[model samples]
Target: MPLARRSLIEAAAARFGWRRAYGTTTEVDQLLNEQTETAYRDAPDHAALATAKNTDALTVQPGVLDARGRVLGEVLYLEGLLAGARNRRLPQELIARLEDVVDHGHELTVLLADTVRATAAAHTAGH
Candidate 1:
């Protein structure tokens, strides 16, 4: 609603959204780096890095990361926002949607973890 509030939302999106979404900082930074390179690859080194730092949100996806750094899907980013940081009363419909997003997040997280573990094991076994 206000400038400060909007800034706070964007900051939260970067912190809570990206980390929780991808489940790790390394992978998240990898995606961020890739996105930065994709955008400023042709620019001078310092300029590119600065641009990347400035426009990171425009580059990296807010949530989720691909194992091969490709395709992925999005889900809730603020599912736990109110629980952890703030408590705002939301409409019933919005609350239900939040619940659904969280439910889907749980399911997808488990699926992704299992798939990644299996893939790692197979690679270790020389697959």
Candidate 2:
């Protein structure tokens, strides 16, 4: 995979807790790696920008909830790209990887939201 794509993928994996099974290599991982390489080759500028944005978001966000929100926003941005891919009739395989990324983003968003809510509830109870 291209460096830009690999960096972005690593950042996302770290944020979302995506893990490869200990003993199994999955199709999703292969497809994602291939598609990200292709994507970087085709759009190096975009890939670099995305990687930078993700890195900056992680570093610059003020608090836990803010960082989560930034990640959620990045996911929404990626969904827009996925929509474009669908409209352009890109390969189903590539589209599938994009969908998986978006799905993970949604999962992270929900998990963060729940955490925020639980924290607020605890604070209220303490007060």
Candidate 3:
């Protein structure tokens, strides 16, 4: 499923659980907001990698062994790459992304609430 839809489902499920058990809309809304905000805050960082095209700096010597031990010539490698690169940039993006994620989460929570309200109304009308 699409990432956004999956996020919605998870939030909706949590909200439904809270509402069904406690009949508390406020609590359920809070829970849904918290969950969804977390998800958006954690969205993948595609922007940081925009500079990844600089991989041309790598110089791979001919004859590198693959996992099967087969020799492969001329592998394109990334130069000046750090093992903890992602970790380093994550902190930089965290606060900004957290706010973005929170906004998205709020939208998701609102959408979920509307859907639930509509579904319940439909069921009530049918009955």
| lDDT (Cα atoms) of all candidates against the true structure | 0.56, 0.76, 0.46
Query: Per TM-score, what order, best first?
Result: 2, 1, 3
Tens-digit lDDT track for model 3 on 12-76?
Answer: 98887732342577756766887799898987664555345323212111111121122111111
Model 1 lDDT per residue over 1-127, tens place: 4546745766888886553345577756865876687788766686566566645332322222353222223443546642433356766665777676667776777776666666556556864
lDDT of prediction 2: 0.76
Error of 3 at 32 (Å): 22
* 33-117 per-residue lDDT for model 2 (tens digits): 7779888788758556655664533332235588688989999999998999999999999799999999999999898877677
Point to the candidate with the largest lDDT: 2
C-alpha RMSD of candidate 1: 14.2
Candidate 2: RMSD to truth: 13.8
Global lDDT for candidate 3?
0.46
- Those runs of model 1 whose alpha carbons end farther than 4 Å from true positions after fitting are 1-76, 81-86, 125-127
Clash count per candidate: 0, 0, 0
**Each prediction's TM-score versus the true structure:** 0.36, 0.51, 0.27
Report the Cα lDDT for candidate 1: 0.56
Show the colliding residue pairs in model 3: none
